[model samples]
Target: MRIGVIGGGAIGLLLASLLKQTGYSPVLYVRTEAQKNEINEKGILYLPGEITSYVYAEHIKDLSQMDIYFICVKQHDICSVNSRLSGLSGTVIYLQNGMGHVDMLHNMTEEQTIVLGTCEHGAKKRDQRTVIHTGKGKINLALYNGNAALLTRYKEVLNDKRFPVEQVADWGIMLIDKLMINIVINPITALFQVKNGELLTNTHLHKLAKVVCSEACAVLEVNEQQQWKRITYIIEQTKENDSSMKEDIALGRQSEVEGILGYVLKKTSHQSSVIHFLYLSIKALEEKRG
Candidate 1:
C-alpha cells in the first residue's frame, strides 16, 4: 500500500519510519525544502539506535498518489492544510489530539474517506529527520464517515507488534475517551510546568486533576472512576515526559487548549467553572507569551 504522511513532525516521522519498517511505501509531506532534501538524501533517522531508512518527501503543494494520507499534524495546524486536503481523494486518516478537528473534518471533500484516529504513542522529534520513540502506545481508530470496510483494510496495514492499532465501532466514544485524558492532564501540567508524574505525586495537583476530571465527566456524561484510572495510568506510563501542551507553551507556540476544553464547553450547556478557568488561564498564557 502506498501511504503518505502529512506534517513532518514527531508523529509524522515516527509513522513514516514504522510503515517503512513493515514493508510499506510511506511518503512524507515535508514543510521546508531543507527537510525534504535532507530526508530524500539521508532518509529518516530514528532512535535509540539511530536506525535510518529512506522515504520520499514532497512539498505540500506537490501532491502524491497514494492509497492513504495520515494527517499527523496538531489540531491547531490542521486548518493551514485543510484546503489542500480537500483537493485530494483518498483515505485521509486524521490523528489529531482532541475532538476539535471533528468539525473541521465536515468541511472536507465528500469524495475522500475520513477516518478518525486517537494515538496514545509517545514520540519526540530530535530534529527535522529524527524522532525518538519515547514510549510504545496503541492507535485507536474509528470511521466517522465513509466506507466502514476501510477500517478492516487499515487494521491489516497499520497494525504491527511495536505499534498496535484497533478499530472501534463507536467514534464518539473513542473521541471522548481520549479527550477526557487530555482535559485532565494537559492543562494542569502546562500551567504548573511539571512532568506527567508530578500530577500523581503532588497531592494538591492530584486533587485538582480529580476535580477537573469530575467536571468533564459531569458535562460529558461519562464514568468518573473509569476515566480517572485512565488518566493515572497514562500519567504513570509517560511519567517522565513533558506534555505536548507544556512543550507548546515553552516553545512559544499555540497549544490545543481550545480543542481539549473548548470543544466540551461548546458541546454542553452545563457550566464547568474549573474547566472554564483553566481554559482562560491557558489563553492568558498565550496572550502573555505573544
Candidate 2:
C-alpha cells in the first residue's frame, strides 16, 4: 500500500524506514527541497549500525495520491500544515504527544478519517539524513470518529512484530496515558539537561518529576500513585534515551510544553506552582532559543 509520512523529524524518518523495510514504498513529506533531494539521493540512514534505506520524499503540495497519511509532526508544528491536510482523502493517523491536537480532528471534513495514536518508540535525529532508533515500542491506535475499515487498512499496512500495532477502544484515555509520561519526563529532563534515566538517579529531579506527575494526575483525573508507578516504569524502560523535549531544547526548537503541560494545566481546577513554573521555564527556553 502506498503511504505518506509527514514531518522529517525522528519519528517520521523511523516510520518511513520501518515501512520501507517491510517492502512498502512510503513517501516522506518533508519541509524543504534540500531534505527531499537528500532522501531521494542518499536515502535515510536508520542507525545502530548506520544502515541506509531509500524512501521517496515529496513536498506537501500534493497529498492526494497517498492511500494513508501519518501526521508525525510535533503537536505545535502541526498547525503550519493543518489547512493543507484538511480535504485530503484516506486515513490520517496523528502521532503527537499531548491532547492539544484533539480539537483539530474536530475540524476535519466528514470524509476525512481520524486515527489517533502515540509512538512508544524512541528515536533521535543524528543528522539531516539519519535517525537512530533508541527504543523499540509498539504503536497504540484507536479511531477517534471514523469507519473501522480505515483502521483495518492502516493496521494491515503498519502492523508487524518489530513495530507491532494494537487497537484500543478509547483514544482519549490512550493519549492521556501518553501525556502522563510526557508531562513528567519531558519538562524535567529538558530543564535539567539530562537523559531519561538521570531523573531516577537524581533525588532532586526525581522529586520534581513526582510533583509534576502528581499535579497532572489530579488534573487528568487519573490515579496519582498508580500513574507514578507507570512513570517510573517508563523511566526504567527508556533510561538511556533522551526525552523529546530535551532534544528540542538542544536543537533550539519550540517544544510541545503547551500541548503537554498547557493542556493539563487548563483542565486543572487548582493551581500547581511547580507545574506552572516548569511550564513557564520551558516557554522561556523556547523564546530564548529562538
Candidate 3:
C-alpha cells in the first residue's frame, strides 16, 4: 500500500518511520521544500535506538494518489489540507489531538473512507529529519464514516510489535477519552511548566487536576471515576514526557487549547468555572508568548 503521511511534525515523522519499518515505502508530505529535500537526503532519524528510515518525501500539495493517508497536523491546520484530502479516494485517518476537527469530516465524499485516530505515543521533533520517540503507545482508531472492512484490514496491516494499532467501536468515545486526558494534563502542565508526572507528584497540582477532571467529566457526561483512572494511568506511562501544549507554550507556538478545553466549553449548557479558568489561562499564555 502506498501510504502518505501529511505534516512533518513529531507525529508525522514517527508515523513515516514506522511505516518504513513495517515494510511499506510510505511518502511523507512535509510543509516545506527544504524539509522535504532534507528528509529525502538524510532520511528520518528515529531516536532512542538511532534508527534511520529512508522514506519518500514530497510537498503537501502533491498529497493525492495514495492508498492511505495519515493526517498528522494539528487541529488548526486541518482546514488548510481538507481540500487536498477531499480530492483523494483513499482512507484518510486524522491523528489530531482534539474533537475540533470532527465537524470538518462531514464534508468528505461518500467514496472516500474517513477514519479518526488518537495517538498515545509521545514523540518530539528534534529537527527537520529527526524525531525522538519518548514513549511507546498504541494508535487507537475508530471509523468515523466509511468501509468497516477497510478499517479492520488496516488495523492488522498497521499493527506492529513496536507500533501497535487498535480499533475502537465508537469514534466519539475514543476522542472523548483522549480529550479528557488532554484537558487535565495539557493546561495544568502548561500553566505550571511541569512534566506529566508532576500532576501526580505535586499534591496541589494533583488537586487542581482532579477538579479540572471533574468539570470535564460533568461537561461530557462521562464517568468521572473511570476517566480519572485512565488519565492517571496515561500520566504515569508518559511521565517523563512534556505535554504538547507545554512544548508549544515554551516554543511560543499556538497550542490546541481551543480544540480541547474550548470544545468542552462549547458543549456545556452552563458555565463550568474551572474549565473556563483554564481556557482563559491558556489563551492568555498564548497571547503573552506569541
Query: In order, what lDDT does every prediction score?
Result: 0.87, 0.87, 0.91
Which whole-number lDDT from 0 to 100 does residue 119 have in model 3?
94
Evaluated with TM-score, which candidate comes out highest? 3
lDDT order of candidates, top first:
3, 1, 2
Report how far off residue 59 is in candidate 2 (Å). Answer: 1.5
For residue 193, model 3's alpha carbon misses the true position, in angstroms, by 0.8
RMSD of each: 1.5, 1.3, 1.1
* Residue-pair clashes per candidate: 0, 0, 0
> Runs in model 2 with CA error above 4 Å?
none
* Model 2, span 76-107: residue lDDT tens: 77777678876667778899998899876667
Off by over 4 Å in 1: 269-272
Residue-pair clashes, model 3: 0
Report how far off residue 238 is in candidate 3 (Å). 1.5
Which residue pairs show collisions in model 2? none
